[model samples]
Target: MLLISIIKTALELLVKLLELSNEGLHRLLSDAGFTEQRAKCQQRLADWLQGVARVLTQDGRQMTGSYAEGWANSMVQVNGRTAADSDIDWTVLAPGQEFHLRGGCERKGSCKDATPLQVKEGHAQVAVGAGSQPAVTATACGVRPAQDTCHAIECCSSFFKNRIRKLLPYNFDKVHLVRATRPSSTNELRVSFSFQEKDIMRNLSTDQGQLFTLIKFIFKRHLPLTLDTPGLKTYHAKTLLFFMLEKNDTHPSIEAWQPHNLIALLKESLDMMLSFIDSSSSPNECMPHFFMPDAPLYFKNAGIGGDFDNTKARVRDRLCELRSDISGVVEQLRGLVRPLQSEKFYFHPFTLLPLTAPPAVTEIRKGMYSPEMYYKFADVYSVVHQCVSELQSESSDRDTLMRQLSILQQLQWCKCATLCMTAMAHLKFGESEEAERLAMELQRHHVVSGLKPQDIQADKYDEPAKLPEDSDWAWRFCLPCDSPPRFPFLPEFTQTLFTARLSQPLSSHLYVNFRCLSWSLQAELLRNRAPAYAFDHWIKELLGDPDLEELLTLAHYSDCRWHVRLSLQQMEMIEKERRVAMETQDEENIGWVRQKWWRVSNRSGSGSDSGAHRSSEDEEEDEERRLWARARLGLVAMETAAEQRDSWTHTKVSWMRLQ
Candidate 1:
């Protein structure tokens, strides 16, 4: 118990170093020279997307990927892994589309119940609603081909291909784009789009997502190098969770879940997979939402065959291996269970990874940081993690606790990491004035840096899929940073002082790099957003509102430097266009041209300036102002961006055009 407190105290020191100065992440990434690579990736992707969207306007189709869903905002690709071609889930579909019964075929009553979209026998991806935003809503449309323009199922296939080719850029061949398909019933087909899979994944409750990650991480660790033992994969684990939820007919509400049932939830999720393997031992059909209604994507059992038999063998063996690891796996994960579990109403597993001490902690403390139950050290990521877990385990008022936690998680990447942690602790222990100072500092850094609402938007794109009253106590995991800290100075020149000094300065681009925090705050903090993990029934049982207000105010800021550069280049061109439009006095043209750095501001009241002579009524008024005078639509946010530093990378701010 003493060591646990020491461990918590020790983790707190790392936070101080990170937040003491405003140059933490910048310094870390500058040495690695990763900012340039990321800028190139972001710029290239942005340019390509813009070009594609422009091309789509020429035809009847639209690029719904960015607008229908938020693009990756302030994307953090840790270890050079963020820029995969797969990140872009392009949805090239016709707008306001309604399926018309085409051809002189069997009479179908309505398009809602039947779809004419079908692929040729040999080809799989013929481009029909590629897991798109439900391209067509559930409206009863059964018009003749004469009005709607489709003659046969083959025509829809050809139309889809043509649309894809039309929207694709001239260098489409150079860019690798994978198109896949899933069979719906025998004749109907669904687009096996990865973006749609992402959409589904984002819908997972915080608890469900964590459990999925835990399962996948542990499963991957034990799997063979080739992963040839069975068809075990992250997708399989995810599917297991989806079915589990569907079986209980529950939303991602955390309250529906029994308290202290983390282990039970894990076992239940895995057992479902085990049952699935056993039932499908002879190779059977498996599709997402396979057991649920609204059967858009369907898979038919391929019947008995050599290929089918092989698949069955693989699945059976894989599931059996997973089943066998239950005992060992439970023990390994049990180490991470929250302490004082009996006390809390709801506790987040946000610090789930610190079962053992992280290397950063061990190295900083020189072996004194080790938890008694574990032998090895983890990393800086794990250290902060356990601290958060400790915080969560100690509190049940998720609403209040999340404010401090969210701020810490958001600022974890900056030199402000320690300050954020300190602020969180201060808030946790009722030290509001200290917490307020740290939070304001965070706000200053965020406002000046290039951090913006879009970054948070990208971070939270999937949050809308949850119930309105769920709890996010289970938490989210983000990019685990391996940034080494600049050490404390010694007046007497201790050996430790010289050894840990930073070798490089931070790049100016570090401000834009704030999105890849090792952990993200729970959605419970957002207005109307349900806790990522909650009991749906409990939501209904609540007598009053769950205080659905955002605890923190953070905005997507396109800072001074980036704005200046844009003014010189992109804005210059826009200005010229605007001048020409003004000369012509064309209202339409002027409206179409957008100005940079312009926004709809919901600014709050100015800082408090009350004197020590204030009465009790004045103090109460000040408190009221603090509580109610911030953001009107959402949480008031801190705007972050970059200005002066060694150097920085400039990327397109296309998402700013969105509200």
Candidate 2:
């Protein structure tokens, strides 16, 4: 009885600690606005890339990452986060657009007559005249003088006058790409399908995702000191998720997903590590590739078989946390047998899916990665629809209107805020001065709240988080906004990337592409809450394609689109009222119209006012302030890019093979 009491106390303490740890992690994760930061980083990177000439114009600029994937965890160190130790994974479309099958570098330790390109230093092959012509092997890339970094940039700029430029990753000082060559293989190049795995991960069941995440937490935190090393890649953990789910039996009920079952999940996952262990092979061996089973994950420094055995022993010794997480492990197995690990895998469950499905068809399909998003989005929309219905009523009470506005404010949805503020501004029939003041205040909070221009985060809207309406691949596979929505739940793919409630939960500020979002359609979006804003306008301008303004005309017939004529009619009436108020010198009437104009006009972040109280001097001062701020930002950008280039050049020279 005394022993039982002691055990119970220990268990209670463990649970309490786990709960607190979980809460603290949640708080830390929520506070880190990694999404915004990453978006800014990508934008800056993209902008700098544009300075690179044709590198920016190429099709493949993907912000593939944890923040982009909607799976960013608390610590960047553990989850590939951007806060502490972060790396940006930008998918660069090599300037040539076409993949040229090139000969692998000789592995003779040193080159005699030919230029020896060190594999460690990135070897980006650039095409010379055309596709048919032999490409220039741009290896041992460096400028002798440190100042020549600017010269190199200038040379590249002059070479490609009309070409689009590529962006560099801000987190990383320099771009790094490895074209892996096996010890003896000559013609073959091993290209890992990381994006393919990401797609598969996104499709994981909610329970599987939670289980994977928890195990990741344990792997990062409690792994024994001997076994924990950079040599053990996270890919091992990721591969285990899919491998287990492929064969691991699932309970018909939800019982398999309980926290108690999580231990069994981890134990089973750990036991599968045997698959990576080779009995008669070298002390170090590459992990089996889950994406391409034929090619395994080889590392330069994995040790001998006995060395791996020692690591396994160390890991088994450190199973105390794993045992603890279970909370109720018996002394020995009594009921059933534990499964033994397999030496080799011949089957992959991913291949069973129908292959004929088009890319567009595949997109509509999604795993239960974040099932909560659907419900949360529905709840937000329900509130928005209720508010819209109430506000439409001519006899709506002041208290009721305020209540609706309060609810909308609490949601912190820019869509609702835009709609509510617009209504308050244009409600010509009746609304007190207090309502107008409240509307302008919300708009003020929104505008001056540091919403960056459409350019910064505009690149983000074109990733997996978003898909073109179809695979509307125009301008070398750029997914246009007008791409139709493929997923039923994701009805807004054509315009908005992530709907307000469905996207990452942010409180401080929300950044949106106002190019797609017009002020006139603010109320329509609030009423419908679907991603119906057409991307034609934004896409056409960006790609230099002819404007598809013709399709937008058809949008009016649909319930989802804004009635432009009706909106214009309402604006005309307001303009007449403002003109008449100005002629009569009605200050009270002028004050209300002035606030309305501020709501619409000040959307550009200028904070301009045309009221009687306004002065020309203030506008001039604001303009000067903006100009100074921009000049400073530009100078900083140039200095930072130059520093990055110099650092990259230095690293290359150190790691390079001289001609």
Candidate 3:
């Protein structure tokens, strides 16, 4: 009875302890921001613990009864206190709290196996008050008490940093807001960041779109300030030009400034920038160089609001204008020469000689010459010479210009080889012999002076020499004859004493001389006869000795037309001979001759123009000849067989009579 009473007391104490633990769990939930929804959950957990404590108390009282003895004997169950008394330890699990076992746990430990608590999806509990259920809200902690909520601070800080990043060009180490009072206005906000200009420009230039956007934004805010700074202006100009060249947006705001003024400003900027490039240094030594090898030519004319089509047209016009200027300069220089030649008094910055006395300029300026002046003269002379040469046939002014250019070249004032060639080409249209003579003279002079001839005879003429036949008397004299005879002839024939030596016919030597003469007189005639004669001579020589069958085979493999023709002619001759033999009834000659003829004829048919008709005609002739030859031979064999049979019959009759 006393033990029963002790068990009842212990049960009441356990019940009180469970209630206290449940109350503590509710308070913890309220603190962790799960307050409003956790109240009912807390009540249910409290009731469950109360029922368990009541069962334990009732079972303790039943331990003294007979039914309790039977149940305990049947199950052999031990109480929690007895289990704790053995070697095992018990750990109580409270609601809303979990213990994590990192490593494997032994069964004898105080901790029991327990499943982890799964936090509600998309919700995290944040502690707000001590006694109320904890506030449950989104994982980002959107709901909480005023003092405890950090959402507004976090969001505002992130937004501030993002805006700062957009405004600044470089990465920032840290970004924050600090309150400070300003003189102009109180409670005003300002974003501050630090960056390096070099790094900013490097990043900007690498990203074209970003650079353009930044530039456009800056220009929009800062009006009336032309991008004229030393380091920055070129990049700005390049960006603007790229847009204009690609036909992108041409903002009208830039048009308020004069085009001429903008060009002048850009020119000045470019010149200043170029001047900074040291003339003595290599390109690699120049810092911040941007021009590529194939970079397009940029001029001051491509300024803002400058029409691109008009600019290109203006460039062409400027070239034409330069031609006129160069022509005028040449005229002025020519006039200077006249005064110098006439021994008239003159004063000019170009002339080094004093003009106080007669012949002073001409006499003193004989050997001395300036290379720079010569280069300029050459440039102008070439242009004038081309213009003149093109128009020489139509205009006398152009002829006079050509003559002036020739004089410049002859005086060694201009290295105008191309211009001279142009003039010579133009002159050749009317005076071919004169052009040829001049070309020869130039070649001879180059050879004498040990200089390579700039122009060769073969390069000047596209057509080969076209000597007319000797039958045309007028053309014979019209040919270019050398002053000194090219071939030696007998001199003073009337008073000559001739001696003759014993000699064989000079046909071979004469033929050789004739061939050389023909080649020299006209290259076209030589080209025409060379291939035919070469093939004919080769075949005649090769066929003379039958041992040249390998060469013939090679020729056949080459499939040249000459070889094919020769082979066909030979085959046709053989076939004709065989046919003649058959017609004459030459039986003994037919078989061997017919076989050889057929082989040659078949081989001859493998030629380019050996068409169906030609092939069929050859085949038909070969077949007819072979048939006739075979028929004639067959008749002869039949006659021989009949004669043998008659002789055998006579012998048999003689033998029978003798028997």
Question: What is the TM-score of each predicted model, taking all chains together?
Answer: 0.30, 0.33, 0.15
- The candidates, ranked best first by TM-score, are 2, 1, 3
Write the residue-wise lDDT of candidate 1 on 1-659 in tens digits. 99999999988987755532224323332222223333333333333233322322223221222212222221222121111111222233343443322221133454335544323422223334343122221111100000011111211212232222322212111111122233332323333223333344434443444445445544443342234443344445555655665565435555534323444666676677656555532344433333222222212233324354465555456556656555444334333222221111111111112112223232222222112112111233444444444343544354544443443343223334444445555556676666556545543332112112222222232121111112112122221222322111111111011111121121000011111110111111121232222222222222111100100111111112232233233323433423111212122112212221221121132122212234564456434333222211112453311220001122123324344
lDDT of 2 by residue, 1-659 (tens): 99999999999988656644433233332233222333333333322222221122223344333323433232321211122222223344355322211122332333223442222111223322122111112111000000000100000111111110111111112122223334333332233334444444444444455456545544543352323633344456666665666555333245554444555666677666544554325344445655334445543334333364454434444454445543221111111111212111111111111111112110112232223222322233333334433444556665765555454343333343334433442443344344344343433332111112332333443331211112111111111122222211111221222112111111111112222223223323232333333333322332211112111221221211123322333334433422111111122222322222322332344433222233474455435333322322233366654554455455445433331
lDDT (CA) per prediction: 0.31, 0.32, 0.25
Which structure among the candidates has the greatest TM-score?
Answer: 2
Alpha-carbon shift of residue 339 in model 1 (angstroms): 19
Off by over 4 Å in 1: 1-86, 94-188, 191-200, 215-235, 252-259, 284-311, 324-659
Model 3 global lDDT (CA atoms, 0 to 1): 0.25
Give the alpha carbon lDDT tens digit for every residue of 436-536 in model 3.
Answer: 34433332221011001121112222221111111111100000111212111111110011111112111000000111111122211122332312444
RMSD, candidate 1, Å: 26.4
Worst 10-residue lDDT window, candidate 3: 140-149
